[model samples]
Target: MPMPDMNLLIALDALLEEGSVVGAARRMHLSPAAMSRTLTRIREALGDPVLVRAGRGLVPTPRALALQAQVRSLVEQANEVFQARDEVDMSLLERRFNVRSNDVFFGAFGGQLVDTLRVHAPLSTLRFAPEGEGDDDALREGRIDLHVTSRRNFGPEIKVQLLFYTRFVALAREDHPIFDAPITPESFVRYDHVSVSRRGRAHGPIDLALEALGLSRRVALTTPNFHSAIFSTASSNLIVSLPETVLWGMRELGLRMRPFVIPLDFEPVQVVQAWHPRCDKDPAHRWLRQTVKQICATVEERNAGVWPQP
Candidate 1:
């Protein structure tokens, strides 16, 4: 079967509403001859002379009268499909957002973020997933709504926004020997270290920084997550280096540990929130990003001293 001309629907709508070829032509900004041709096409397509001469003006045929309301409704609905959505009612929005991040982020601000969402978008749910091996396919596939991390090599197509900056600090048992004297590059390297790496690697930027100072620390233990590193450091002499911001909520856990400044000068870690471009204009996704930013700001304020050093 042949497809019908969609343009004829607009012309038919104008002709029925105006009830005159000249008036319809003016409404559609077309010549009277062109409008007459369009009306002839509409008649042939519908097998009905949709408009007929009634004295000095045109009157709709019974079939055209029956279709006027339906045609108007279809045109109105089509117009709405192309228009921008300008408002969102939060209370009425029900959605689930899956956020992927390291354990440190969840341990720090996950509770606060959930609480904020409960108060603002009561019907929405938040899910946290662990950051697996630096892959971004979850975001591109829409499985993960947001990704929070310090490493930002998610490729050019992914949209990234800086959430906050943090610096590495040494975490050790409260009465560890490192606290007995002033920490220097020489003294800091003397203690055995516990290193955290998601990929199970033993060395990182800390090793490189120490190498530049003609010093090196012994990474006696390797852990995949911050919590394990903290537990290991708290119970033994192993000193662990982690971002200061990650320790935001650790105090509530009653962990017997203290943080001290790392002696070597290293670049600050940039923590960012990334998402796929597919959800850039979605109102619900936009709200999720804004809420994540607000939560990061609140966490930063509560732990002001953890910011990147100059």
Candidate 2:
């Protein structure tokens, strides 16, 4: 079957509304003769003389009357589809955004994120999902809205923006004997350590740094998250290494721990927020991204002197 010209729908709608060919022509900025030809096409397309002569005026046929409401509705919907979405009415926005991030990020900035949303988008909710191997797939499939973590090559398709940069710091119980003496490579390797690894692998950059100095620390315990490692270190002599941002968050939560430099040249980790290309222009998603960026900026400002610059 042949496709009908969509232009005819507009002409038909004008013709039915105006009733007179001259009036419809004026409404569409067309000549009377052009409108008459358009009505002819609409009749041919629909197999009906939608408007017919009635004395000195014209009236719509029963078929045209039946289609009047439907045509107008479709045209209105099409207009909305092409409209600009640069702004959103926050109070009217009722939606749930799923964010995937590690516990450290949540611990550091999640409270601020919630406070911002409460004042701006009161009705919207945030759902933070744990990071996993399927985060890329979840983002592509629309199962997740944003992915926040350390920056890595997520191929070329994912959109990423740097939130902040952080480096690891050694943490231990506040009164540990390590604090009584000057910290050096030798002393750092003397304490039994607690390692935090999501995959449960013991060795990391610290081990490599120690190996360079012909020294190694015993990893007495390995936990999956910074919270567990902090809890373990607070009550025991086991030392743990964690991002400076995570340690700051832990301090805010009243965890008794002390942070010290690792005494090794380690690259700073670039923490970033990532999203799928599909959500690049979504107003709600844009707002969420901006909020996260603002929170990170605040954190950076607050810790200007504490966290060393790269």
Candidate 3:
């Protein structure tokens, strides 16, 4: 038996990804004719028309669809094998990391994160992308290095690690009339409310908890992030419910906001950091992940004694 040409794997992976010979050629820096020849060889090796012409373009065959993820994984692993390093010297490392997270996280620990990275990887850059409301393919597509979120519906190939936990706490202006008395379900519902949801949702666990008690509070405002909701409380009678840890962050900003426990049983938010398995063995990526975990712990420790949390 003739030995199979392992180089065909790269062409096959590129063809399956682009769904067009020209696009694959451009990706591999080859001419269209050369890409076509490579594609023919790949078709013969795999015994499948990996991409078939359809409506002026090409679509993957069922076989190609099944092999897509596997092929990509193999290619990534092969590249890692060739590029593997024994150790990553942080002082000399120069790379940019893209992290996606909500504003609450940025407001609370963004400065510390940047400072820590500057000290460790002086030439490295940290870019923070805003969280999206819809299903995101950023991690799998390699658009972002890390996704810090409470969402757990990521594809099976994504690796996840718990960062920390937080629960909801209500915030109001320092001199709001609500501060005059002990907060209860009834008093908490007396004033209008502000909410933070990336999906523009006007209700959430807070509403369900209120409904359980036969009590309902009107959401007078809905902002797409916690920063807006937190700032809105500074000038209005509206109370905002946000992550408990964010209160300390607000205090550091010298915002005259008062924090009080919401009078309802609520689930703790299990914050997690997710990434693609492609970065699993990359030394620099591993160091970045460890740095994030360390930053979260520092934030958690600094927030202690500031609020009574469960």
lDDT of 1 at 41: 96
Question: Model 3, 1-310: lDDT tens per residue?
Answer: 9998878888888888788999999999999999999988888888998889899999999999888867887888889888898688988888999999988788777888899888989999999999876647788767789999888999998999999998888889989999898889999999999978878899999999999999999999988988878778898899999887677676567887778889999898999999998898788899889988988886566667566455
* Candidate 1 structure quality by residue, lDDT tens digits, 162-205: 99887888888889998899999998989899889988898999
All models: lDDT? 0.85, 0.83, 0.87
Off by over 4 Å in 2: 1-84, 304-310
Give the local distance difference test score of model 2. Answer: 0.83
| Model 3 worst lDDT run, 10 consecutive residues | 301-310
Candidate 2 lDDT over 40-103, as tens digits, reads 9899889999998989999999999999867865664565578548888877799998988889
CA displacement after TM-score superposition, residue 98 of candidate 1 (Å): 0.7
Q: What is the lDDT of residue 133 in candidate 1?
A: 67
- In model 2, the clashing pairs are none
- TM-score (all chains, Cα) for each model: 0.71, 0.70, 0.80
What are the root-mean-square deviations of the candidates from the true structure over C-alphas? 16.5, 15.1, 3.9
